[model samples]
Target: MARPVPAGTARADDITAKARIRNAALELFARDGVEGTSLRAVAAAAGVTVGLIVHHYGTKEALREAVELAIVERFADAIASVPLDSRPAGRIAAARDEAVADMLAASPAIVDYLRRALLDGGGEQGDLVSRLSQLSAQQVHDLRAAGVASTNHTVGEQVLTIMVRQFGRLFLQPLVDRISHEFPEDIDPSRTPPRLTVELALDASRADDRD
Candidate 1:
């Protein structure tokens, strides 16, 4: 007796199912950690059959890898868009902020996924962080090459500092949300945070001008 593989009529042409499965998996994985989520759950959320998910992604682990890869690629694109070579060091921040804001606006689920992945430190999360670190290192190298960053300092140390500060914002978010709500309508505690401290200062400056 021949055993059957789970593969069915699914084809490379099943773009709709593939896209739906990826989105649904990303959403569910964000809400529930990858360990807590299952192919059945993903299929239910995606409104597809487990067999179809298998036909497209082969396994839960593979699907998770795909999701992580997608996130990393998108973030790389966002970071790469910054004019690191052309902009003055101080002016680089504004461009980076705009790129990040746009990225978050397009994919709101990213915040949750990042929080979960970073906290859990499981599966491809380490790889995701590694890829991000590589991107950050590249940014630092570019800044140094442009004579904007500390040329005499250790670039590795600088990269570590940048990584820590970025992760700190996400890891210490409880304090951030509690304190950053005076102008509730103008601020969003839920979205991936921007430089609220700087933004608040800008608001204060605007208020002073009006007064």
Candidate 2:
């Protein structure tokens, strides 16, 4: 149940219109690659004029960049749910898991976008991957600092492995689901650290925190 916008809300520079355009582009881009989608298609999906899209975003490439930015923000916001500073390890672990679970559940389009971006590959897309890896490194460093991450794995190793596993979910997970005959808890490691990496540390961190 969404709240209605007020009367006289100008279409130009309206947050709603921008968000609508962003979401529409995300969906269309995920379903049909950026090459296949058109400004008119995005405008139609967003229920706004093609002229309005051009006015707001200028071009399809600009619109794609906007969608990429929104996707990064979603991942960042999920990480932000548990600040990396001196929070309790138990709380951080729970919050991290909850945040990622919520993000994956909510952002199927984002997952699809990630799949396309990672597979397609480009300079800008490479930047997106680098940012995502940096986010993973942040979590690994903090979890280790909090004494919740394994000491055995180097931070670089952990970061690399985490990125591989999370992106693997984007491609292999469908086959995994088919073979396993069950859905995953739907945690996107791209959005959070892998469950096993942190779970193994939970008891140790809780013990260390009490000492």
Candidate 3:
């Protein structure tokens, strides 16, 4: 038998219910894709009434938008959490550690959602790509201003380089894991590095100041 909710907890329960619906939708959408998922199915998966799902989000598209915003906010928060003054390697180590921690705690559905969103080439995907590219370019600008990164490459090139390095893990983890499986765990480069990560910046001091 289920326990009854205490009196005066309706607001809290409502909040919980909304979150549950959102999470359930994310999982289902990742598995079934947005075109294949339905509100009734999401409500059933979330243990809520279909009416409640509608009450929280007017439509499935709204719910998906909410999920997309949450994902983008999470990535922004992760980047913002690192300090600007830290050494390049230290900053990367902190960001990497935070990312690993998030990965461990995050639902696999989130990863699936991102993969689907990018691969499906949804209309919003262009915006997502643009945002990430701008962010990468900003990071390159900061690093170069601080004398940590090379200025040999243009901002566009820097963005592309960083994006490839950053997003590659998300898109190609399975391939990397398979190829690295034969290697001993002790020296497997796929594994997270020690706390003090090596500097990824090129030696700007020696490079020509072209860009």
Candidate 2, pairs of clashing residues:
none
In the range 1-211, model 3's lDDT, one tens digit per residue, is 2122222222234448887777777777777898888888888877888999889999998998766665665566566566566545435634634564364235467678777877885456435566666666776777677765665767786666565555656677666656555665656476673332222344466333322
TM-score of 1: 0.68
What C-alpha lDDT do the candidate models reach, one value each?
A: 0.66, 0.67, 0.63
TM for every model, in the order presented, reads 0.68, 0.67, 0.65
- Model 1 off-target regions past 4 Å? 1-16, 122-126, 179-211
**What's each prediction's clash count?**
0, 0, 0
Off by over 4 Å in 3: 1-15, 88-105, 123-127, 134-152, 179-211
lDDT order of candidates, best first? 2, 1, 3
Q: Kindly give the stretch of ten consecutive residues in candidate 3 with the minimal lDDT sum.
A: 1-10
| Per-residue C-alpha lDDT of model 2 across residues 2-109, encoded as one tens digit per residue | 122222222244458877877788888887889988888878877888999989899998898888777767777787777756476556645665576567656777
lDDT of 1 by residue, 124-166 (tens): 5367787777777787777777766664446565556565555
- Model 3: per-residue Cα lDDT at residue 180: 57
Would you list the rank order by TM-score, best first?
1, 2, 3
